[model samples]
Target: MKHLKTPESLLFYMMLIREFELKIAEMFAYGKLAGTMFHLSVGQEATSVGTIAALEEGDFISSHHRGHGHMIALGADIKLMMAEMFGKRTGYCKGKGGSMHIADIELGNLGANGIVGAGIPIATGAAYAVRYRGGKQVVLCPFGDGAVNEGVFHESLNFAALHKLPIVYVIENNQYAMSTSVTKSTSITDLYKRACAYGISGEFVDGMDVEAVLETTKKAVERARRGEGPTLIESRTYRYYGHSRSDPAPYRTKEEEEEWKQRDPIKQYQRKLIERGIITENDVKKMGEEIQKILDEAVKFADESPYPEPSEIFEDIYA
Candidate 1:
């Protein structure tokens, strides 16, 4: 997608993401959703909305398990997404992929990976394809802090740096890898420093700030387009919900979650836009109404769509 030129547009995309995830949560609570593996990026809206805004239309992204926000920000159709959530045949992967494996190749979303740290290699391979074919398209790999310790993370970055592959890696460091805190899992909490070992530029950004993520990712995206090597960006962000619906987040204190909510990305950005005269309270209300209508239609479409037949199960897979 082209860079979002205005603040209002950015806010609209972020609002779309915020609503989509909340709707998913609502569906899960009502037992209307298909699976229990859904991961919601509720508090990390700005990181997704901002990072995707920096990419060109030709670029590709390999998404992590928690990637609904990434896809929604990158212009996914809500109707199809909702259909997939309901496990209907009208979905992007014909309901085969569900929430964790959604992909639309035409849209440059390589697919969301369920295995930890797996998408890194997928993005690296895509970048290699671009370099091999002499294509201008770059690839963005967005994963979590948990992926940093995986062997593939090191291997992929080492190769990308060695060959100067047109790729950018952003770690959505939401402070925990499931229940395990980063402080307990890694030797250094400053994850951007890991990029130094690969001889690439690394920077940290406040993921709560949308513009900051955009600017940081934009520089790296541009650098990759210029045939410069990869970059590692640490987006310091959070998740409002537990790792999954099944988790009550006993590991997280209510006090800490409340503190992080104080810097809520969507609320903060909306306030900034209103203060800067880029939007108004009326505009926000209108945006909400419009989004509600669109989402209602999405839910209707999903509910009416049929599930795939058992006979079609062997079709998409290769022998």
Candidate 2:
């Protein structure tokens, strides 16, 4: 097993993402947020934190609509993120990108795309840029299972394979594409196998297990750094919320949701850490309190921050 950082740090990051997302949900419900739509990756914290833990500072990432966890895991400021959600000028995009389009270019985040499967080709192009400049950076492209059905998915994968681009295509297969299940949407259940069609390696991972995700992504990252080209990783995860803020998620059953909850990544990792004597229950509680305090301050900052002026409406727009 590769030394994938201390278990304590991994657990902390997972908790941070979970708490941040949970707060976002609460804020949205109270009309504290300005956006009309929001997507939460509540049950998918492990996949985001674990995969990102294996990356270096210079590495790049492209995110999907449910991408807050991805940005938080990548060291984004919670206050700024919350400010953006509230349409404040302190946000990463000067309050223009909102929740779905936040990007910190200085941090190597290429920004999250609202369109399905749009980030795939963007990541592929970034990888090509890395290769051309002989840079050691590798790009991680994450999207939903629904994105696999998009034409850009095939085109991007084929082009990356042909040119040996330094990227990893991480498929966050959260079972449902909005209300439609993967079974109803695609004939190929094994999403990773689609990588073979483009002559690249692929692997499936239990998205709830942070350790598994970290180990698997580490190998893929190492391969890309070695100039071995892209690898596809299909992480089977679940979303605890609807596709957006207004979605009720009536398509799934109570039992199905409960079953996935039992495998809650944060709880599972907490158990493992306690079992190994790495941390006590008190430590876990303390960590939770600390994260909660951070988020509380973030919300306060966002609430107090000024919104973008009406005169600035056309400033950031690109013709």
Candidate 3:
């Protein structure tokens, strides 16, 4: 299928992402959201939208703690996502998964994991299953730079390459793994180069450029779909918000944040639309309002929905 490069679609997706994060931040401040807060992939919409656009409907994906963008890009129900965050019975996981664990199997989203590097093996296993079943399904696993420090990360890659599993490992190198800089985490600066030692293909691409990421991921996805083993892609992106609500990002300077903000994915895509004449400034404004309206409706649905009954807790849990 041809990728969506139109200005309207790009602007629409970027606005949807911005509005979603805004609503979540608002809800958090209002005491409507429950559980621990994590890093918000607020500025990284282009990378998610571009790569997801290149995926087939039946293909699988594993998301990290900041997974709302992944879910939204894959067409997960916004109302259900909001409800899950609100801990309501109408949620995707029926209010148990919360933000980090939100999932929709029908959409081919295996599940989002709270633990770093947890999804790597899960996606590797999914890839093995696809190969075993003789299906064309591909599994995409996304994790942060910090996850590379985990043993499972290496183990999963080794297993995937050894067996030629159909999977794509994406590292969103947002500069910092929590408060620690990438410089401090790995001796090898470029995360993608590690793929060579594992005897697999690896590439580092600009995560801020939607077009570049989409084009690169298209090739990687095709390679995996062709039964060629996995590809490790390190998307150099950044998070606008702190590691979590508790962090003010004291480790990084205001100048660094400003430098990244200048390359805002939403703005970059919006400008592309204007330059291409796919959408007007008025169109951008209208898109923003539409997404805000959608978010408002989702918030209302979550607020009005009933919380999970006390008895339901024991039903979803296993011994």
Candidate 4:
């Protein structure tokens, strides 16, 4: 068991993810955010922040549609991220890709995909590139439990391991693939065992615990950087919000939602920080205030930024 070493920096990161997520929620309510949102990382912040922390600056990550947390955790500019959602030219994609398609290649964030499981092959290919160049960079490919059902998931894992590529396939198993729960999707409850078919190591971690996720991911990242091939990690977590903004999550029970909220990774981590003397209530409050100010400025920037001009429509496209 790798014990987590609590540090002040890590506590700050946990707080940032939480504050950013909450700000996004507020933006949605204020009608400031446009486009469809796939919210639900409310209880899964640790899995994102911790895993990203284990990666180096050159390492890459491919995100799911619900990718805001991953991008923020990887040090994406909140202003541009918010601008992209607002369809302003200041977006990472220059206003082309909205919430589902944000990408910052400079930050090693390959991109997020609207199509389910599409990024698996992309991440595998990126890993192959790193291997071909003899670089130590690893790729963290994160998707939901729903992605595992895709044919590309199995094929990509097989190819990644076969070639000894440097990649960590992290399945954010938040219990449900949209409305379908894990119980209704797969017969084998243990998502980790699925890696056996690919002939690689598979580990399960507490997705709600930042320390646990960070420690486990650090090991996997080290192994991959050493050219030990891929590792599949199933992070058992829960999403407090609905699958999308439109979803009421009627299939789930209020009791179930409440139970998961009690296990919220952000709040849990805050308490841990306080308990460890790494941070205090005032520290958390100050962090929250700073994040809100940052986000508020981002919102102002996005609102004031210009939209795409008429001639810009076919610029980035190839016919």
Candidate 5:
């Protein structure tokens, strides 16, 4: 495999995402943060981090509801993200867009959508713009398996293929769409095959493996940048948490959860690093300490930030 990124850097990015997510969960559980709802991708960090790592700065990305990892991986400011979650004035959307609606245009994050499959078309439109402008930038659209059933998924793919838009549709298949299992929802379990209908390349990856995700995404990105049509990548990953904060996810079995836990991306990557002698136990400890310090500061910054004034509610409102 070509090493686009060093193993150590990849492992660090995965750990950063994991730790940031864990911190969010802890804060939310203790009422230290405020939001309408939060969808945690606790077990799906590899897909977000690895894919974003493969993209260049100007490349755009459209995120889904469970998109904290996506924003973090794309270099979103942690403090501002935390502030946004807290509804502070210093947030990316000035406290208006909460956990699900955060957007950083300068960072090329089109925004995270709450509605299923909504971001697909937005990303497709962005890709069209890129092609129209003759820019080499690619747009990466990440959504859940549940989104595959949406009409926009097919429409976006067909349009993208017909126009050869520079975009990559990343399906973060976590097996469950809200409480509905993939088997119960769709007959065609192999999501990549859906791309064949658009006459574009499609493939699957071990989403639990950051290296595999990164490598696969890198290839799709290259194809998109080369003016080839979009690529659909079905990443078979899982989420340790529920669809939302209030979900208990009783639809799944404990045995299955435990099995997936054994393949935890962070732990697996740690083992790989150690086995390859890329990082020692001491190095891991230091890295954890550094991440913890960053999280601590992020929380502090968010806590001290001011809330948006009621008089400013009309600000940034277009309609």
Candidate 6:
């Protein structure tokens, strides 16, 4: 099926992303999920939801470490995703991938990478493959602000630009890269300007505004399909939690965090829809209940699912 562009659908997807990540965070807090490295994109749901909404059915996406929202945006099964996080055999990667390594090629998800900036090249390769096959498909590569400093980012962008690859590189600039703020890491502000170095189109977006992201990405996607080139999009967003479960995020002041939360994407969008008469407070309550029920089932499924057997360890290893 094609993208869901309706206001209701868009808002619903954003809500789904929020609830799913929150559930994971809750599970992780309780030590129910596997592994310790869990990154939550709670405040950045709009970026994932809107960017994916701008894509065509045949288009592919390469996601970074904080990629749960990307998969959820593409309408992935929450139960299987939760199972993967639980390291159960029912997961996409048969439980080996854990939270950071789930991949579903059939869904046109090239996969989610644990390494920063690693997915950029994968997306570039997918775009190149699409171009080589003479297909109209495009690729969306989403990474964090920290990934911009990685060497692979520059290399991938240069290659994509040179070949006019059909890819959109989105920097989910949450201002901070781990503990370091973007300002401290980079010399200049407005990361999208880096696109000039590669000679491709660029967009600076409000990651909190889902519709803005959708409209901006639509133009970029259109350009790529016209055989123009890759586009670099810097969607400035935020994270409601620490980098992972370990970091207490002592660096940022309480006031700063509160300021960001004031523009919470889900709440903002819900208000917008409510004001426009597209949805009422009751509608939002019902939607949350629906998503919560799905999440409940996901956790139950993940808990009930079996873990991978020791003997089958190397069965799916291609590399």
TM-score: which candidate is best? 1
For candidate 5, give the lDDT of residue 107: 84
Better of 4 and 6 by lDDT: 6
* Model 2: colliding residue pairs: none
* Per-residue accuracy of model 3 over 2-99 as CA lDDT, tens digit each: 23455567557766876787788888888898765745778888778877877887899999898888888887788998999888999899998888
Tens-place lDDT per residue, model 4, 1-319, is 1111345556556666666667667777778776656474777788888888888878999988888878877777889987988888888888888888888888898989988899999999999999899888999999999999999998999999899899999999999999999999998889989999989999999998988998899999999999898999999998877888778889899999898888888788789878988789998888778877887888888989999897888798985
lDDT agreement of model 2 with the native: 0.91
* Candidate 2 positional error at 215, Å: 0.4
Q: Can you write out model 6's per-residue Cα lDDT over 1-319, one digit (the tens) per residue?
A: 2646698888899999899988998998888889888888899999999899999887899987888888888889999999999989998889888778777887779989989889988889889999999999999899999999999999999999999998888999998889999989998679999999998988999999999999999899999989999999999999988898788899899999999999999999999999999999999999999999999999999999998899879786775
Candidate lDDT (C-alpha), each:
0.93, 0.91, 0.86, 0.85, 0.90, 0.90
As a whole number from 0 to 100, the lDDT of residue 253 in candidate 3 is 91
Positional deviation of 148 in candidate 2, in angstroms? Answer: 0.3
Error at 309, model 1, angstroms? 1.0
TM-score winner between candidates 1 and 6: 1
The Cα error of candidate 1 at residue 15, in Å, is 1.1
Cα error, residue 251 of model 4, in Å, equals 0.9
- Residue 64 of model 6: what lDDT? 74
TM-score of each: 0.98, 0.97, 0.96, 0.95, 0.97, 0.98
Instruction: Report the lDDT tens digits of candidate 2 across residue range 1-319.
Output: 1222779878887899888878888988799997767888999988998888889888999988999988888878889999999899998888888998988987679989999999999999999999999999999999999999999999999999999888999999999998999999999999999988988999999999999999999999999999998999999999998899899899999999999999999999999999999999999999999999999999999999998988988895776
How many backbone clashes does every candidate have?
A: 0, 0, 0, 0, 0, 0
Q: Which ten residues in a row have the lowest lDDT in candidate 3?
A: 1-10
lDDT tens digits, residues 1-319, model 5?
A: 1222577777776788788878888888879777648888899989998899889978999988998988888777888988988889998889898989988989889989999999999999999999888899999999999999999999999999999899999999999999999999999999999988999999899999998999999999999999888999999999998888889899999999999999999999999889988899999999999889988999999989999999888777775
Model 3: residues with Cα > 4 Å off, grouped in runs: 1-7
Clashing pairs in 3: none
Local distance difference test, candidate 1: 0.93
